[model samples]
Target: MEGSLCDLPAGLRGDYAAAGPDFTLPQDWAAYTPADHATWRTLYARQAALLPPHAATAYREGLARLDFTAGVPDFAEATARLRAATGWSLVAVPGLLPDDAFFAHLAARRFPVTRWIRRPEELDYIVEPDIFHDAFGHVPLLTQPDFARFLEAYGQLGDAAARIGALKPLARLYWHMVEFGLIREGGAIRAYGAGILSSSAETLHATTGAAARRLRFDLRRVLRSDYFIDHLQPTYFVIDDFSKLFGAMRDLPAQLAAARDAAPIPPGAAAPGDQPIP
Candidate 1:
C-alpha cells in the first residue's frame, strides 16, 4: 500500500469501531456494491498479468496460493487462508493508523489493511490506500517465511525508533524499501514493494523507466535516505535476497540511534557510501 500514510479519522461517518482497544473495525463487506468488486477485479487482472515478469519471486509465489478468479475477496476469507499458511491475518482499519498502532499490529503478525475500496475513478491513483492496495499489493509477500519475519522485525524496530525520536529516518526506510523498493532477479530488476506492485504505471517505470536510479541495498544508507510520496519514486533500493532484509537488520536499533541526527540523502542522488547500480 503506497500511500498507507494518511490517517483516516477513527470515528467518522463510515468508520466501524470494532471490539478492541487497538481500534480495529469490521470490514463491513456487505456494504460493498457490485461496482466495488468489479473495480477490484479490473485492478487485479491488469496488475496480475504484468507482475509475473516484474514482481519478486516471494510475491509471485505468495500470490499463487490465493485465488482471485472471483472478484473481490472477503477479508474473513483472506484472513483464514493467510493465517493457516503463515500465522498472519488481516484486520480492517479505517485507514492508516498512528505509527504505534501500525507497529503493534505488525508486531503481533496482524496486518491492518484498509477496508474500503477505491472508486472506479480512483483506479489509477489515490492519495490514500484502499483495500485493493493493502490486500493486493502487500498481503502476498506475507506468505513468504523470511519476508514475514522481516516485517515483524520491522514493526519491533519501528516501535523502538519511535521512542528515541528516530522514527523519521525509520519512515524513510519504510518508504523506499517496503513501499517502493526494487529487487534484482536473474540479473534483472524486479519490484517487491507493494506500491509498485499495485501501480501498473510505476511497475513499468521501476523496471524500465527513464531516470530511475536503482541502487544496491545498503542498510546504513537506506535508513538515512529520503523519498517522495506524491509521485513516482525517483529512486529505489534493490536487495539481493528477501532474507537479506532480516540479516542486515540485526544492528538496526543501534544504527538508528547513532544516525538519528544524520542529514538525509535526498532522493535520486547518490550518497557518499552508495554503490550506484549501473
Candidate 2:
C-alpha cells in the first residue's frame, strides 16, 4: 500500500482473472479457513491494544463502533455500519488496483478492500495489504465524516491528476497524508494514517520513537516529498484537523502541477520552509 500504483505487487493471492471490470470480487467469507480467522483475531488483538493511547480520536471512536475483534468481519455487516456512518460501503478487490480503478471507487464512495488475509507466518509483516490492513486499519477511519470527505476529494482529484500525467506527485500526497499522516490532538501527536495504525512497529515508531521527524502538513511540501515503502518513514507530515485536509483539495490540481515541476525532497531530508514539530 505504500508503493506507487504502478509499483504494486503482482503475485498477491487473489482471483484477479475473475474480477469484474471494476477489479472487485466476492469476499467469499465462508471460504476462510479457521486458521485465517485465527490470524485476523491475533492481528486485531495486537493492533487494537496499541491504538488507544497513540491513535487519533476519530480512529479510536470509529473502531469502537465495529467488532473486528471477533475475527475477519463479514463485509456486508461492516458495510452496513460504514454506510450508516459516512454513506460509504466496502467492495472486495483482488489486491491493489490500478490508479484509475482505485480512484473511481473512492469517488463513488466505495472502498476496495482486498479479499485475502495474510498467512500466520507473515503476521509481523506483509509485503502487500491484506484484509486485515484494508478492513481494520483503513475502514474505521472511513466512519469519520471529515476524513471521509478528504478521501473522496482525494479520489476526485486523482482523475484530474491522471489526465495531466501528474499522479507521481499526487501519490506522494497520498503516501504522506493518507498512509502515514499524523495529527496534533489534545497536546499530543496521534497516528491516523492506516499504514501506521496497522503495523505494530510503525504504530510505536511513529507515535513514540525518536527516529522520524514530524513536520507540519504543507500541501506543496508533501507533494514534493519522497517516502519509504519497505521501512519506517523518516519524515511524517502532521495536519491540525481533517477539515484542513479536505481544504487542501481546493487548489490541489494547481499545486500538484507546481509540485510536478519542482524537484522532490528526499525521504528523511528537511527543506528550508518545513515547520518541524517537537
Candidate 3:
C-alpha cells in the first residue's frame, strides 16, 4: 500500500481504460458486483461509527446532506446532492491522476474520484486510491461552502505552481492539510482530513495513538514538511479555524514563493519557527 501509481497492489488487475486529459471517466455503476457493494457497506459502517467522537461536525452534517450509505453511491445521485448544496460535483477518474489534471478538475469545482473500488483484501491498505477512499473519504467535506472554496482555490493555485516547478511545496500543503490535518472544536481537537476520514483504523490511531505528534497548524511549516505516503502520519497539524485555511489561499502564490527557499522537514520534525501544539 506504499508508493505511487506504479506501486499497485500485487497480483490484482482491472482493465480500466486510459483516462482523458481531464482524467474523467464513467462510474459504470451497474458494473459493481455484490462483493464491491459489500466492501463499501463494511468500510462505511465501521468508519461511520468511529467518526462522531473524532471527526469534525461538518463531515457528519455533510453525510446527512448526501449520504453514501446503503451501498456504493451512484455518481449521478451523489453528485446531484453535492451540486445542489455547494456547486461541487463528483466526477469519475481511472485512478491516481497527474497533478495538473487533478488541479484542473478542482478548479472547475469537480472532484475526480477513482471509478473502481478496492479489493476486499485491500480494505485497509491500497497503493492507489480506490472509490471508497476518494468518495467516502473526500466528497462529504466538499459539500461545505467555505471548505469547497478552499479546495477550488488550491486547485487554481496548484495549476499555476505546476507550471513554474513549484508544485512540490503545494503538494506538501495538500498532503498535510487536506489529507492528514486536524482542527479544533469546543477546545477539542478533531480529524477533518480525508486520509483520516475513510480509514477506521487510522482514525482511531490519529486521534488517540500514543506515538502521534499533534502540532499547531502553520502554513510555511506545512509546505516545508515531508510525509510518509505508506504509513500512519507521524504528525498532525491542527488548525483553530477553517477560515484560517481559506484566508491563506488569498496569498498562496506569494506563500509558495517564500516557502520555495526553505528545505522540507520530514514528518515528526518541526522547524524552529513552528508554534508546536501542546
Candidates in order, TM-scores: namely: 0.92, 0.96, 0.92
Cα deviation at 259, candidate 1, in Å, is: 2.8
lDDT of 3 by residue, 138-208 (tens): 88888878889999999888757866678789989998899887888998778988899888777987877
Pairs of colliding residues, candidate 2: none
Q: Which 10 consecutive positions of candidate 3 have the poorest summed lDDT?
A: 1-10
lDDT (0 to 1) per candidate: 0.82, 0.89, 0.82
**RMSD after CA superposition, every candidate:** 3.4, 2.7, 3.6
lDDT per residue as tens, model 2, 24-57: 8888899999999999999999998998899999
Tens digits of lDDT, candidate 1, 1-278 = 11222454444423544424576878778888999889988999999999878999888988877775467778788888888888999888877677878888888999998878888998999888888888889998888887888888888776679779998878877887888878888898999899999999999989888788888998888888888877888888999888888787797887897668888888777777667676
Error of 1 at 250 (Å): 0.6
Q: How badly does each model clash, as a count of residue pairs?
A: 0, 0, 1
Clashing pairs in 1: none
Estimate the overall C-alpha local distance difference test score of candidate 1: 0.82
Cα-based lDDT at residue 87, candidate 2: 96
> In terms of TM-score, how similar is model 3 to the real structure?
0.92
